[model samples]
Target: MGESIVITSGKGGVGKTTSTANISVALANFGKKVVAVDGDIGLRNLDIILGLENRIVYNLVDVVKKRCRTKQALIRDKKNENLFLLPASQVDDKSAVTPEDMKELCSELKEEFDFVIIDCPAGIEQGFKNALAGADSAIVITTPEVSPVRDADRVIGLLQHHEIPASLILNRLSVQMVERGDMMSREDVEDILAIKILGLVVEDQEIVNAGNLGTPAVLNQNSPAGQAYLRIAQRILGENVEIPSFEEKKGFLARLLGR
Candidate 1:
């Protein structure tokens, strides 16, 4: 069976959705069938990030309501055929689908795909619970800021309470700021969260540009953030790829210039 993973953050604006879109594309590039589900009802945008916004006819709510079959709601990726998107309902609120419904939907998707990635909504409300319902594993995303880190710590505790395995993905990290003692380092965040590090995505403008253009950063070979996400996908597949040090000034510069 396929693994159902949730990409979540305790707070908004932490790049959780971006990570979900990029990781889904990365796994698809590795020859894995992947489906990304947007768990944020009433404010769905996973389709836009995947560049499949114009193709969404049936959404998650439609499937749950039996208005259409699961296959009818899936939007296949234009770049990678192995990737698909199950968009959330733009009209319905978070209460439209229960946690049990999410579990059943994820289980059904796992039967046909190699990976099911749920882009969870921010906060620990009903939407968060629904997103966590079917996830076998979770990737908690956070930035170096104090508020995000504190929120991530709370999320990790909640995951532990639910007996769900989780790892940390530190996003929007700035190496120069860390070196200058202006930001927290990877080790510092890990120490506070007490979770295994899945990956570290450095601050890169190319990621923003890629998202704006409806292309995932992971598909951009020249992007350092893309390389970091690819390595994370390899790790998810049980590969022992060495994660390069992003703390060094020269190493950061080299990666930024695509060297």
Candidate 2:
């Protein structure tokens, strides 16, 4: 059976949807049949990020309510034939779907796709519970800020309580700030969250531009953020690829200034 992984964060605006979109595309590039599910009902944006917003005829709510077949709700990606998107309902609220409903949907999806990546909503409410219900594993996204890190800790505790295997994806990291003691380092976040690191994404403007253009950054090989997401996908597939160090990317002038 294929694995279902939820990309989630405790607080909002930490790049959960972006991670979902990029990783799904990256996995598709690796020859895997991947489906990206938007679990944030009513506040759904995964479809927009994947550039399938205009193509969504049906959504997760429809599948759960038996209003449409699962296949009918899947929107194929324009860039990758193996990639698909299951968008969330904009009209329905979180109460429209239950945890049981999500579990059944994910179970069905796992049979057909090599990977099911669920883009979970922010907060620890019904949406979060619904997203976690069917996930075999989870990737928690957090920034270097204190609030996001604290929220991530709470999320990790909940994952542990439910016995779900979770990994950390540190997002929007700045190498210069970390070296200058102006921001939290990877070690600092790891020390607090106490989870295995799946990936470290550097701050990049290209990510925003790619989202605005409705293309995942992973499709652009020139983007560092895209390359970082690709590495994360490789690691998820059990590849033995080493994660490149951020320090190594720093300029000589930056290093000298830090010294």
- The top-ranked prediction according to TM-score is 2
Q: Tell me the spans in candidate 1 whose CA falls farther than 4 Å from its real position.
A: 248-259
Writing each residue's lDDT as its tens digit, candidate 2 over 1-259 gives 8999999999999999999999999999999999999999999999888988899899999999999999999999998999999999999999999999999999999999999999999999999999999999999999999999999999999999999999999999998898777898888888988899999999998999998999999888889899999999999999988867756345568767984
Q: What is candidate 2's local distance difference test score?
A: 0.94
Query: lDDT at 177 for candidate 1?
Result: 91
Which candidate tops lDDT?
Answer: 2
Model 1, residue pairs in steric clash: none
The TM-score of predicted model 1 comes to 0.95
TM-score of each model, paired residue for residue: 0.95, 0.96
Give the Å error, residue 229, model 2: 0.2
Taking the tens digit of each residue's C-alpha lDDT, what string does model 1 give over 9-128?
Answer: 899999989999999999999999999999999999888888889998999999999999999999999989999999999999999999999999999999999999999999999999
Backbone clashes under 3 angstroms, per model: 0, 0
